[model samples]
Target chain A: AQTVTQSQPEMSVQEAETVTLSCTYDTSESDYYLFWYKQPPSRQMILVIRQEAYKQQNATENRFSVNFQKAAKSFSLKISDSQLGDAAMYFCAYGRGGSEKLVFGKGTKLTVNP
Target chain B: GAGVSQSPSNKVTEKGKDVELRCDPISGHTALYWYRQRLGQGLEFLIYFQGNSAPDKSGLPSDRFSAERTGESVSTLTIQRTQQEDSAVYLCASSPTGYRNQPQHFGDGTRLSIL
Candidate 1:
């Protein structure tokens, strides 16, 4: 069984500043995928970024990027130039290549202050 | 539908009553998933469907919970003798494939309340 943990329950960043949300996971599988998802006030789950365990290089999508340390079993998400729209709940998820289940963390509430 | 669609956006039922939630996946999507989200908690996997293959019910919390998907289209999650603890948001997602690399698009979810 894989379990994702988000130690930070809440995070805040000033507008235009940067913020990082921490995430860690426990998985025995060597081949797997890590994902960051955002849920805004609308409560819609949106994919933020994704990183593959085999890919040593981190994944970046516009302002969202991930710091994936496979050896440490850590995958953190960084949001640069944060805006008010970035205020939401962020979740870290883990899943295997052929598996349909995604294990998710409790989530980190991000507050972007003006 | 253009995206995953969950019907009866909000449903309130009495305890011990049966409730059914429906999901319409995006056209052409081959994978469908059901998850439960309790207040202030993370999402929990419930069931999964891939094309016409045998559905995965391993994540179901109890025998009272069951789900069925028609090919690659609609899906229904049924809860028999619902309990107050069953109050939560039921979310549905669809992906082009069941592969981990494929991102799953989610629905707004059905808010189920068992009173």
Candidate 2:
């Protein structure tokens, strides 16, 4: 069984600053995918970023980037130039290459102060 | 629909009542998933359906909870004699099949409250 862990329960960052949310997982599979999902007050789960275990290069999406260390089983989300709209519950998830289900970690609530 | 849509944005039913939550996935998606999210908790995978394959009910909490998808378009999660523990937001997501890198698109979710 694969399990994701988000050590931080809550985090806050000032507007225009940077925030890094930590995530780690335990999986025996060699091929898998990692994802970060955001859920605002509206309760819609939106995909933030994705990282393929086979890819050595980190994935970047504009202000959102991931530091993926496959050997350490660590995948952290870095949000640069944070805005108020970035305040939400961020969840770290893991899925195997051939699996249809995703294992999610307890979310970390992020609050951006203006 | 332009995105995944869930019906009954909010549902309040007494304990012991049965409730049905609907999910309509994106037109071209071949995989649909059902999950439960309690307040301040992460997503709990409930069931999964892919194309015409047998649905995975391994994640379901109990026999009271069952789900079915008609063809590849829509799905319904039915909870019989709902309990207080069943009170949570039911979320639905869809993804493109055979694409390992595809991300799942989600609906806002249906919040079920048991009184």
Candidate 3:
């Protein structure tokens, strides 16, 4: 079974600063997908970014990006110019290709200090 | 535009009572999923439905938990004789297809509280 691990239980960053949330996974499959999801106080899970294991280039979305090191099985999310709205619980998820189930990490609570 | 819809944003029920949670997927989405999020924890996959294929019940924790979907439409998750342990936020999501590249859009989960 594939498993995702987020070592940081909580993280804090000042506004306009940068922060990285670390994530690692264990998977035997060569092709898989990794994702970072943010959950606000409203209880809605929002997709922050994603990376495909087969792709060598890291994925970037606006201020959010991921450093995907496939060989190390490490996928970390970096948030630049963070804002107060970015404060939330972030979760890392992994799913193998052709599989419908996604395994999630415990989660990292991010706090943006203004 | 509207996203996935889930009814009764909050549900408080007694132990041993049966409760049904509803989820209306985005129109035309071929895949729908159910997950449970305990407080301060990550989401846990519960069940999945894709197109007309047989639903996947592998993630279901026990026989007490069951779910149903109607031809790429609404899905209902039922918890029979619920236990306090069953209390958690039940979330529903949908994607254009069950493809790996497509990310799942989620609904504000229904917080189920067992009293």
Q: Give the Cα lDDT of each candidate.
A: 0.93, 0.95, 0.94
Best by lDDT: 2
lDDT of 2 by residue, A1-114 (tens): 889999999999999999999999999999899999999999999999999999999999999999999989999999999999999999999999988788999999999999
Give the lDDT of residue A42 in candidate 2: 93
- Candidate that beats the other on lDDT, 1 or 2, i.e. the better one: 2
| Interface root mean square deviation per prediction | 1.1, 1.5, 1.1
Task: Give lDDT tens digits, candidate 3, residues B1-115.
Answer: 4799998899999999999999999999999999999988899999999999999899999999999998989999999999999999999999999887479999999999999
Residue-wise lDDT of candidate 3 within A1-114, one digit each (tens)? 888999999999999999999999999999899999999999889999988888899999999999998889999999999999999999999988998778899999999999
lDDT tens string, model 2, B4-71?
A: 99999999999999999999999989999999998888999999999999998989999999999999
Residue range A47-104, candidate 1, lDDT tens digits: 9998889999999999999999999999999999999999999999998888878999
Q: TM-score of predicted model 2?
A: 0.98
- Residue A23 lDDT in candidate 3: 98
Candidate 2, superposed: residue stretches over 4 Å from native: B98-101
Winning model by DockQ: 3
RMSD of model 2, in Å?
Answer: 0.9
